[model samples]
Target chain A: MSWQLGIEHLRDLARGAAILGTGGGGDPLIGRLLVEQAIREHGPVTVVDPDELADDAFVIPTAQMGAPTVIVEKIPRGSEPVGALRALEKHLGRHADATMPIECGGINSMIPLLVAARTGLPVVDADGMGRAFPELQMETFSVYGVPGSPMAIAGEHDETVVIDTGTDNKQMEWLARGITIRLGGVAHIAEYSMTGAEVKRTAVPRTLSLGLSIGRAVREARAVHADPVEAIRDALAPTLYSHLRVLFRGKVVDVERRTLEGFARGRARFTSYDGTSELELRFQNENLVAEVDGEVVCTVPDLICVLEGDTAEPITTEGLRYGQRVTVVGISTPALMRTPEALAVFGPSCFGLDVEFNPVEDRAETPAGVATSLAP
Target chain B: MSWQLGIEHLRDLARGAAILGTGGGGDPLIGRLLVEQAIREHGPVTVVDPDELADDAFVIPTAQMGAPTVIVEKIPRGSEPVGALRALEKHLGRHADATMPIECGGINSMIPLLVAARTGLPVVDADGMGRAFPELQMETFSVYGVPGSPMAIAGEHDETVVIDTGTDNKQMEWLARGITIRLGGVAHIAEYSMTGAEVKRTAVPRTLSLGLSIGRAVREARAVHADPVEAIRDALAPTLYSHLRVLFRGKVVDVERRTLEGFARGRARFTSYDGTSELELRFQNENLVAEVDGEVVCTVPDLICVLEGDTAEPITTEGLRYGQRVTVVGISTPALMRTPEALAVFGPSCFGLDVEFNPVEDRAETPAGVATSLAP
Candidate 1:
């Protein structure tokens, strides 16, 4: 099945992407506006489900690479993503039949649509990650054995860099990040070039509609004066996401932010108005660990989202401010992400946390050794 | 007229290139050995004079990019320069008939020969920079109105980044340098792809032979126990280089080295045996300025070379060490580099120094001022 994404779907998609961004992916405010403008100018973009893709279809994933803080200052030129896609197609000596998002996260989730709008190419409704990750190799495509190149990265100045890093996706990221920093802190990339068969095999299907529906549910709940968090839970019940829980509701009392290694990193602390409970969230671009009174409540491979308490607006890691009332939610990731292979790269141990892997839902109830869904 | 670069010529070229490297360009030791090996395996490369080229011949310049300090640690894969040239040729949609050095500094002077050795292509006996400058925009091709792309940069892992920065050569250099750092601190690049006509118009002719002759002179002088510095002077007298002077001879007493912004930078101080006079050499990869007893004696756009006092071996800026006995020499640059456009980008004021630039030859005879021959 396929659908047309008009301005009507932009807000919900952006909203859900922000939630899936896990407090990183950068703020989607500008990206949402840009996609909206592109769609309005170029007409609605067709988004086909991965299953609907022709086996021979050439599908290229596109995203922006850089620090969220730098993106805030540079504000994407809007033409770079499209330019990168075109350049990649030229290098491959073939036209892309469809486009895909490298991941479902903040601004990146919408970048493919911008490219599709300009190129008149349909965007597939699946993504490499069901949610966002900080590095290139963390993508499902790479994790499942697809190469990251031949990839093309383009700058707004008509400058383009087409790279073929062979099988080393880590080196690809290193080179891409280095080039991004020099291109005034941001560059748009079209990588993970694959056939439709390969994409259907490795991609997390239906993430586009999932993000859109999640956003719509939250927005609809707020209209009727209902709890938007509950709306998100209800909306996710039918999806691959298994468990959802509200971990904390408090006012942000402190935020220690620092730009390190080209990423915005630090911790945000929140305390209940009654002063009896406290929660601390530590992050590197994305929220990686969350704890309540020194008890590990949530860790990575699972989602940790911080939202503005009153309106249910998700706050990005870079946008977290001191003294803002917020709610933190924990959601279970897809089963594919909990596999030993995936856990080795993105699990709690990978982040150097002292605790073992415990599902967010069980962590609060058991608080002790519980056999993890992923027992690596 | 065209000649061949044998092992004999390699020694002279390396020596002359070190002198032209102006205390930077990393040490040519490893580069010379690599070239010698390549020549032994593939036979001597044909060196074509720019004026003898066909009007439509494709001339691509090749060089290594990154910190010279890093080059010492991460000796090149030896195939990267050839790979870059091949990739650039593919991108250009035309075969390159010949290779050329981007500059006559450090290892770059020999990289083109390495490419020619493998591809069976001839190397032009000219270069973009009569001497080396740290940035890409400071090249004769750029100064003379040639663009920096479509250029290709290849890494040791077979990772290649082909970029087209249009007329913004500075942006090209920024992107290339950034890529080089990620490529294990070093990469090889082929840029300024041009026609033989452009090479004849813009390239500094005979630099390859100039470096070769300089090296031969120094080696011959040392063989007979004659003054090597005087030999260098005699060798350069027949070329565009106007004046050659032995600026100082002393024992290095103080040396400070620090890696800053990917370049080894600092100052080396030497004092005469009697300690009556002192020489200070300040460098950024390559030596940029030399002062004698608080008086500015040499600056860039002119060559400032340092050699081991006894063996007449050229010492790169990164190789400077305390307690080493050395002699410093200054040589006038080609008139082409003295143009206002070139000086505006490579002169003393461009380096943030307060003093105005004076022709090195005139600086010694007339401390106040003397009219420069190629004044803009």
Candidate 2:
């Protein structure tokens, strides 16, 4: 059965999503409209719990992979993803029974809802990653040894490819990037084939609900004129909370962004409150780490979310500008990305930092309600 | 029927192909050896006449498209072209009647031969262009409105992509390049589907035979006391010989090469006996032009061939260096790429030259044998 969010929750959902999006999702207005349109056109997509999926349900996760700049220009022709999925099934000689989101940030999270409605597949209440981490292989799937190849990549002119390569996840990303650049820099892929068993084991189940809860908290916090940031802490309660850690955040005094060897790279240095201490952010999409002076204050598999402290709006790593009032808030990643393999790709070294990866729990206690995986 | 070429001819073929490769084709040694190995394995490929094929033949032309720098680093898996072609035909639901060389230079010229030996597809005698110009639309097919999008791009990882977009050839290149960059810079492609009728109308027919002739001319000229330049003149006779202007013969004083906007773009200003006239070479995969002394010397559709003035050993554009005594020779383009559509992509202006594109006959008269549409 479909569970609908009334108009009242939609604002909060969007605001909170923008926060969980961790600054990589495009403007929430467009994403909101797309989702609102999809819901309006096809009724609401039924979000089924991962437990509801059959053990053998054909589950595939989907997302748009490549440069974000390209995504804005090449408005998808609407049917490419569904076309890719059907093409994938045709190539595989079977249909997927369910679908999941590949990333929780940006339009990636809501993309599954539209795709699920169109494919008649239930949306798995889970995602490959709890927050964005740049490439396809940076997901929990890869850390868990899931293959990103043998998926379908489609172009608007109906060129659908069933891509299978011996390439490691990183290499496959390089190949698909050609299509993205050629298609004006964005490519949509239907990937991450799994059974319900695999999804239940590997995914950060119901993180959207977590996103929804965080979104609602921010909305409710604002409704009563409470601290939206504090509201987020309560909503993501038990998983994370507001902090008073004094790290400098103001205008991005300088930013250096470059895509080299297939990775979007660069760092941002900002001056907060007369530039007493500089706040620096190094990222490859979602904020990977924030540093004060020379020390890494926070790192990946943990959210390094920057919000307009007063407005609570998510700020992208690329667009971080000078003189913006930012509050760098950290959230522990959902279990999916916390795996060591995922960390190897998202952690300090991935961003060229020298710090050893420390679990989110080691640095800060999670709020009361979220499930925390006990360390091995 | 099979044609015969002695080792002497193959040597010249290799040399001339390298020179004609502009600066982008991989080192000719690889193509030469693969060919030598093929000759050693299954005998030399039968060089068919343009009229040898059936009228209803499905001709599939193929080549490599991406950054040349990435090619040598990521060696082709060799079996990729066949994989790309087979995939194309699988999509087309028919077997190809013949294979055509997409261009008559370095990596592109030999690729069709490789596919032919591997897939049992008969090789077409013609190529889409007589020499090389950068970009897919520079070909005779695109000049005649051929599509570049639906082409299959396959890499060493065996990752295969059939890219088809609604965008024109130029935009198609832009998008394909993104994927190419994503894929670590190089990939093999089998593209440009055409009927036998289309092949007859637009391609630079018998260009391989011409390449062989040029190769033989160089070898024979060097074997005896005859001038190697004269042999080159004879080998490239008729079509390419139309421009008999010898720009200069002196050691290169300076060489500079740079990659920009996906092209090996830079001018090699040379110190020649003719008071240092610079040779400007621009190539995507092949050299597009050779201008000398503030004059409109040579342009696309026309071949700008460079060689060691004394020995006739071909000098590739990218491989050109300081202290080499070289001669820049111009050969006219086939009528195919001289059309308005072709001019838009490969003409003088296409390469950012200010001069209008004129046939070689308008520029200079050849010694003899070189075919000129202007002569007819």
Candidate 3:
């Protein structure tokens, strides 16, 4: 089903997308404001179902690429994403029938909305990554046979670079990452241009609506004095991310973070309230692994999200700070994302983690593996 | 005002270009071999004068951009320059009427020949830099108001990146440099696409012919047992570059070179045979400053070329080594390149040198300033 996403829907969408961002995907509040401003100026955008599009319809996925920490300070010039889209359209000599999110997480989920709002093009309700990954090759679109090249990246001053050839998606990411650093550590990109059929086959479907539902559930639960953490679990119960669990309830004790090679890379350690247990989360932009006392509890392609202890609000990697009371959650990724092919692209080993791919459900089933209590 | 460049002309062109390279521009022998291979397969390329072009003729300048040190080891695939040219043509949606050299030095001079030999496009007998400068922005084309982008860069594996927008030439260079490093240390580029009128007004005219004359002079002088260094001076007597002098004749004692940020950078120290003085040549790809006994004798936007003491063969920075018998030559740049606007772009300070850009003639006028003798 298609829906009209007006200014009113932005807050919930941002909240839900932040949760899905895991820890990366840039700052949600900044993205929300940018989207709100764009929509306010250009009017509401239509969120279309991927299935409703013709096979010949051209769809372009657009997002931001850089260290989330840099994006926090280097606010996008708002026109960068639209400029990138237009540049790509000009390069391909085709008008995009719809714009979609490359990744349905944090600011990336909102970038397409901003582009759609500004260009008056409907946004397809799907994304390459249902949850964020650090590099471009990690996308399901690439894993499922979409070329990342013929991609356009735009900087704040309207500088546009179109990468027309890459041996593979990894090379494309390498080239784009280098350019992004030169473009002031952040750039808006329009890439993975696909036909409607490819979008229907490769994209994670209905992610925008899913983000909105997750956001609304948390908001409603809060108003009704219900446990927002349980509300989040209920929201994912009927979705592809059906296995959700609270990995830990603790205060952030240490964060060793540094912006490196176009990514925010670091490890954050949390101490449980009883002070006897510890959880360590290592991230490269987004949370990639969660370890309880050095025992792996969850690793990507499973979501390892850090949320506020009481409010259940998503906390991005850049937003993590010492002494903050937090709740860590682990949710299983979609079946398509956990496939052997997909895992090869974004599995724990891809992030240089020593562990193998193990689903969150399997890890959570072990009684001693997780601290599910929500108490701070 | 046009001539055919067959396999016979390549030797002279490469020799002259290496002199003009001012100790940078990659390895001439490697470039010559690549061009020779291409020409043998595709036949000769026509060299057209700037004046011969129709006002609306589409011209693109093609060259290799990276450290000379890297280009020597990496070696081009011979197809990269043409790939870059074709990609840029596609981006612009216009067929190029001709190709030209972005610089009249080293491997860059041969790159356009290779592209033309392959594409059957005539090469304009002109270039952006009469002599080479390390960065893209340090070009007469840019100094005289040509845009550096809508530029295309192609790697060995056929990966192409088109930079369609850069606020200015420096930003274009900065962006291209970052991409070049990611492209495995060397990349071929087609940039500064312009109209024939822009070419006529901005380019350093007939640099290819000038390079040929310099090479022929050195070769003939050597064949006849004449002073090859003096022959080099005579070759530039009537050209736009009228001032020439031997800055030093000595054996290289210490050479410190490292490839950094896509440019070969270091200093070579030369000791006079009498052991009374020392000459230090500091360079970033291309020689930027020549200091004799810690006193500046030459600096950009003039040329500081290093040549074999006996053979007068131009030696690139990457080829510099301790114990090599060498002679440093300083030549005045053309009047157009000495303009305030041009100096601001490539002057001494631009390379972080402390001295002002004094013409080589002024510096050589002081008898104690340079050693003009041919003795080792």
Candidate 4:
């Protein structure tokens, strides 16, 4: 169904998003409140189908990249994306005809509305990538040959700088991140310029609707007190599912970070409520892999999500810390991310994992390394 | 300075490049032979000034970025930069009019000639970065707003991928480096598409000649039996000779490398000829500083060049190793690199110095870590 931002719809959208966010998207309640409040204050967002787009329409997609943990405490100034959009418009010498999500999970899902509301641009019901990625260039647009540079990327206080990685994503990342670090850790980026022609060719068609639908299913489950996770799994129809491994649900035991080329990279360890088991999540941007008992289980391209222990609610990486109860969950990559190019973008190796590619099935067969479960 | 080259010019260019390669450009011997043979078999390269560029003059820049050690063992299978050029030109719908260096240091300076001569494009008198940076986007062009996307990068066997990193050098770096690792740790890239206007704004002017002159100075010093270290010093005209520290010639005792985000970041310890003292070189890509007896002398933005031991020749970071004799030299950043913008680009903090900027003068009086050296 199209967006109607009624309390019921917002409820459903949040629930469904929890399931579909697969482990990486932040808890949807906050975003739901935000989107709902924004809608309540501004009116419900109207989602336009890509097929409805005019041929000459300009479409822009935007998102936040960096450690998810950083996003929680720092909170976006909310002006960065808007500023980036305005800058892009200035550069293009025209207003964007439309805009869409670059990623449909976590804060990114809500960001489209915030930006759309500000730009007066229709929010397209689509996304560039079907799932989360560690870097800006991993989007499907790059796979389809879209440019990611000369992009209007803004930081806190509306500090905006356009980057032209000139086909070098590493350089582009360094340039944007260097500026962002100069501004602070988090940044709002508006990247991936496309003609309607190219957008049609590359975008994950109707992903915004998928986001909405995923949101809806989770709502229905919670309303009926059903399993929201199952509701999401059924909705996405993911090609495969590995046996789930619940890593831990106690408190964050440790967190350490190192700045390399100015990006936050490090690891976090959490202990179980039982105080007997421990879970470790290693990440650069999105959580890449999870290890229990010192054994690798979930890997990149696959999803490593965290939830509030009792409620089974989603937990953005940044929200994780000591005394925070979190249950870790893993989701296999949808068949879309399994594409060679997609894997090339998010594979285990992409995260510097030394292990060779082991598809979801093989991943499950491997024993979970939960600390208490170890042979000790 | 203009166009047209005879056999003599190719020999001069190659020989001059090797002399200046600072011992890290890979053995110029084979590459020089290949290029020399290419020029001899075909014709000499015509060097054209950027001003002479035709509006449609197809120009591409090429370079090697990785553990330089890998480049020697894995000689190109006769593709790479040429393959990148083919992929780029194929996408551009035009033949290249010229090819140029990514940077005029080490082997990278000569790598572009492989593509230039192979594609029949004149060698350009411009380079992307005035000096070598460890990562792809650390170019003079990147600082000036040139991007690294919409690129043609590939492996030796010509596994070409035409990519647009969308203006984030970080993305380009991630993608190119991902490809490089996928291709076994070496990828040749041809990037930076300018409308001549962009190039004029961003590309460092006269860096190639600067390199040639620096290389020439070293050659002249050796011929006259002058200290090559003094020759490079004479060539660069350091702001403070008082801070000059010709650290001891020595052999590496240990090396530590961490392949985080595809960069080899670590430090090296060396024992001088006296064997009682020690020198350590800290590196990200190029050497950023030199410490003798635990004192910091050179720092980033300033240059910490390592020339060969005895011979006092320049040695690239990757060229350094255990049991290899090397003389450490330091040079200050050009005034251009001293600007806040330039310092921001290559400052001590940029390379993880974690200190305030300090000029070479005070750096000598106290040394890099002495609190004597702070990033400005």
Candidate 5:
């Protein structure tokens, strides 16, 4: 059965998306507001599972491309996503049957729902990345042989660009990011076009529901005065993200960030309240590596999430600031992301890091009540 | 009636385009080779006057966007221009009846011919810019109220982007140049789409024929051992450009160039062979200002052409080198370009220059036997 996403579910979705964001995908506040506004105006958005999609269903994946800092300043015109999709449809000589998130984290997660609300097309429950990724070609769709273009991008200034980079998703991302910079640092893109069958085979299934559950768990825990951190662990325990643990609980002490080639690249350091060991996080739009006391603690595609110590609010990489007390959580990615084909794209080596990727579950000690597998 | 663009004519067109280039538009060598290959493979392209077009005929303008230095290094796949046009046409749901050059100068002139040769469409004898300018919004089409967007850009990597910037051409140029940089420093673009009636009403008519005539004059002058500088003046005097004069005859002494924001911006200084005076040329894609011996000579909206002293070969901005003997010629622009609306866009102030624009014919001393009138 299909489910409708209304205002009641927005908070949970935002929380869940942030958990999956893994410290990237940009902040979801504006995206959540945009989705709420769209849903209110156009009524509730319908979301369908991958199995429910017809064989010939035309699915389009979309997200905002640019630095998170820029996205916060450049609000979309609301019509750009629809305009871009229409332009792409005009180019393809057909209409899309559904929309889907390019990734499950941050703004990308909400953008597809907003697009669905506006276009009246049901959004698929699956996403390209089970978690947020910094680059376009890193998606499971590409690993499964889905071409990134012919893609469509629409700027806030009523400008739309349709890109065709063949199978080279890297080139497409380079070109798209370039346009995004010119569009005042942010632009909406619809790419990774596929049929329902392709989506079912390659996509990370039920990610939408997973994010919602994560968000709801935190919200319910907060209302009942339960531990939100433990709630997150319990929420993801039965899902693809079966392993979860807190890597550090400390105050941010240092951050070094610079916008390079339209990406926010930098590192953040945190120190324990007792002045013990320090944790350093490196990222390019998303946290790529986490080192505690100069030892590698976790690496991508394993999740590295930063949540507020008290409010349990997830903090995006772009939102990292000095002196904020936060808890860093690590979670195991879906089994699909561990395959050789997927690892080559999302592993630490792909990001130019030298360390061999150790699954977060294997690196972290299993808690008293939790059973786990350490096999790679 | 339509006419064929032969190899002989191609040489004249390139030469003429270089003259009109006003030290920008980029080097024409690669563009010439691309067009030659296209013509050789697809047979000669057809050239048609604006008056010959059907009112409803779809006319698309095309050009290569990027720095000349970049174009020299990154060659095209030869199919990108046609591919971009096809993409635009597919988006528009109609085939273009004709092709037009966005400018009459440098590589832009040859790109249309190449596109025409490949698409089997007639090349319009009109252009948006009588001479090249640094930005896309400076076109006569924009001044005359034609929008710049609903345009398509294609990369050599098989990527195409369609833009719609509404009444904002500056944004369009910014976005387009950004895409160009990401496409390995250069990309083919098809923009400023219009109908045949709109083309006739707003386009600088007969720019192709005008460029051809200027080129032929220089070629014939070189062959017959006549004064090439005088030949240029005589050639332009009969067309919409009535007043022409030699601004300086000198050897380049120094050049300062920097690639910034995807444009080759710099200044070139030349001292007369007899060491009597010096001429300074400042450019951004095209020469915008010229000064002789610390006095203003000619500025943008007027042509500041640099030619080989003996051969009358025009030199582009990027090709400027120390010690090259050259003759600088200034030609009055079309009457259409001098309008208040047009001047507001292409004037000196638009380029951040402090000087008020004075028509070249008004500023320059009228030679004996030459009748000139200058009024804005």
Candidate 6:
């Protein structure tokens, strides 16, 4: 299916993508405004399903890379992502048939739409990571055999760097990270160029639509005075992230965060309403692991999302505050993202976590008593 | 005029380049070995005068970037310079008519020779810097108006990055420096691509010949048991660096050096043989300032070269050691390099030194008594 993403669809998309960002991928608000302005100037962009593309369609994924905390201050000039795409296209000697998101989370989900709007190219309804991960090589495209090279990065001042080397994806991440830090802790990148067949085979499909669905559900729930958290659970019921649960509901007690090595890294502590139980969340740009009372219940490649207790609006890692009432939710990742190969790239061990990989559903089942405890 | 740079000429070239290196540009011996191996395998490279090139000739300068201290440990794989050259050529969509050294000092003088030998391309006898300076923007090509991008950088593992943007020379240096650090402390770069007319107008002409002359003078002086330091002064008498003076003769008492921000930086303190006065040489890769008895006697864009007291062998900052009997020498930079415009780019204050722009010739004159004091 193909659809048009107008300014009307941006709010829902940003909202949904924020939840999918897993507490990283930069602030969705900035992305929304940038996309809104780009669309207002260039018109709405077409969103094409991955299956609707011809096999030879050239698809390039675009995203912003660096600490989300930095993105809040050093907003991109909006032309950077398009500059990266054009630079890549010039290097490859071909125009891209469509643009896509490297990760269908946070600002990245909005980046492709901005690129598509400006360039009159359609955006594919897919992404490399169905949810966000901090590093470039964490993409499913890389795990499924896509080279991250011939990649182009653009800075706010119109500087463009093209890495056309034979380095493996991990080395690519290291090199790009170093450059991103130099580009004032933020850069726009167009990488993981692929054909339609490669996208169909490797990319997490329908992720854009999934984000929209999730965002719409939250918005609708808020309008009707229903429980937005429950609405989020219902929204994911039919998706790859089918298993969802509210790990904890509490007020944030502390947030120890710093922008380090081009990442928003920190830990947030939450105390239960009665102050009997505590939960701690560790993140590097995106939430990596969550522990309830010092016991691990959720970790990557599962989505650990922090949302406002009442509105269910996603709170990125950088947005976590000292006293905000919030709910920590964990949703199971897609089966393809949990395979041994995928796990080796973005699993708990990769983030230096001592725990082993355990799916959210298995680790924290929807207990009958807990499910009905939510305030309605 | 053109000349063949055979393997036999490398020793003289390296020795002369070391003197011109101003205690930076990496160790000449490493560059010598790399060039020697390349020539032995691929045969001699032809060195051509900048005037020999046609106006349309595409010329690219190549060099190694990073701390000289690191180059001593991480010897290049010998293919990086060529790799950078080829990558730049690919980015420009043209084959280079000739290769040239970005600087006539230290390892850089030999890098272009290696690239030329490997690619069967003739090297221009001119260079951007007649003597070495630490930063990429401190070149005549930049001072006289040549952009640094589209530049190419290549790592030991064949990783190549190309900067193809509108950034000015300083920003290009910053971007390239960040990438070089990530490339494991050392990388090869091909930059300042220009036409033959630009090369002829902007380059410090005949620097390779000057290095050869200085090397020959030192070698012959040593063969006959004469003063090699005086030979260096005599060798430069007819060149643009005509004002050469032996600044101090002393034993190194203290050396403080560290590899920081991809540069070899520190200060070496030398005491007179009789321990009457002290000379402090502050450097960032190449020596930038020489202070004698707390008075600034020499500073960039002049050459502050350190040499063995007896052998007159040029010693890079990385090679400075405690207790070594050394002579500090200052030579005037080219007239073009000392211009107000050039000074603005590479003058004393550029290195964060408090001293004003004073040429080596004006600061220290050759006293008749001091000239006669050299041991015969």
Per-candidate iRMSD: 0.9, 3.3, 1.4, 11.2, 1.6, 1.2
DockQ for all models: 0.82, 0.44, 0.81, 0.04, 0.65, 0.83
lDDT tens digits by residue: candidate 5, B115-134: 99988999999999998887
Model 4: how far residue B18 lies from native, Å: 4.8
Model 1 complex DockQ against the native: 0.82
What value does the lDDT take at residue B177 in candidate 1?
79
DockQ category of candidate 6 = high
Tens digits of per-residue lDDT, candidate 5, A156-247, equal 76677777788888887787777777777778888898999999999999999999999999999999988888899899889989988788
Candidate 5, TM-score of its B chain: 0.95
lDDT of 5 at A231: 95
**Preferred candidate (TM-score higher): 1 or 6:** 6
Q: What is the lDDT of residue B122 in candidate 5?
A: 93
**Which tens-of-lDDT digit does each residue in B1-376 have in candidate 2?**
5464334456667666665564556555666666665656655566666677666778888777665655555667577778778767765667888788887777777777777766666778788767766677667777776675567777666777665554366665665565565566666777788888878877878877766667677777778868776776655556633445454455566666665555666666554454534555555445666555545566666666666767767676567778777766666665666778878877778767677777756774322212111111
Give stretches of model 3 more than 4 Å off.
Answer: A364-376, B364-376
Per-model TM-score (chain A alone): 0.94, 0.87, 0.97, 0.81, 0.95, 0.97
Interface RMSD of 1: 0.9
Q: List, residue by residue over B1-376, the lDDT tens digit for candidate 4.
A: 5766554444345434543343334544456656666776677676777776676555678776665556666676445678777766666666766778877666676677666666677777766655566667666677767776667766554445554546777566655665565566667777876655555566655555555556667777878887776676676563222234454566778877554544556678887555666877777655666678877666765656666755555555565667776666655544555668766766777776766677766555432222221112
A1-376 per-residue lDDT for model 6 (tens digits): 7998899999999999999999998888888998899999999999999999999999999999999999889987789999999999998888999999999999999998989988999999999899999999999999899898989999888889998656498888988898999999999999999999999999999999999999999999999999898898999999888999888878899999998888889999988776677888999999999898878889999999999888989999888888898888999899999999999999999999999988888875423215445433
Stretches of candidate 1 exceeding 4 Å from the true structure:
A352-355, A366-376, B365-376
* Per-residue C-alpha lDDT of model 2 across residues A18-68, encoded as one tens digit per residue: 666666654344455666666676666777888778788889887766554
Query: By the TM-score metric, which is better: model 1 or model 2?
Result: 1
Query: How displaced is residue B202 in candidate 1, in Å?
Result: 0.8
Please report how far candidate 4 places residue A225 from its true position, in Å: 10
Error of 1 at A42 (Å): 1.4
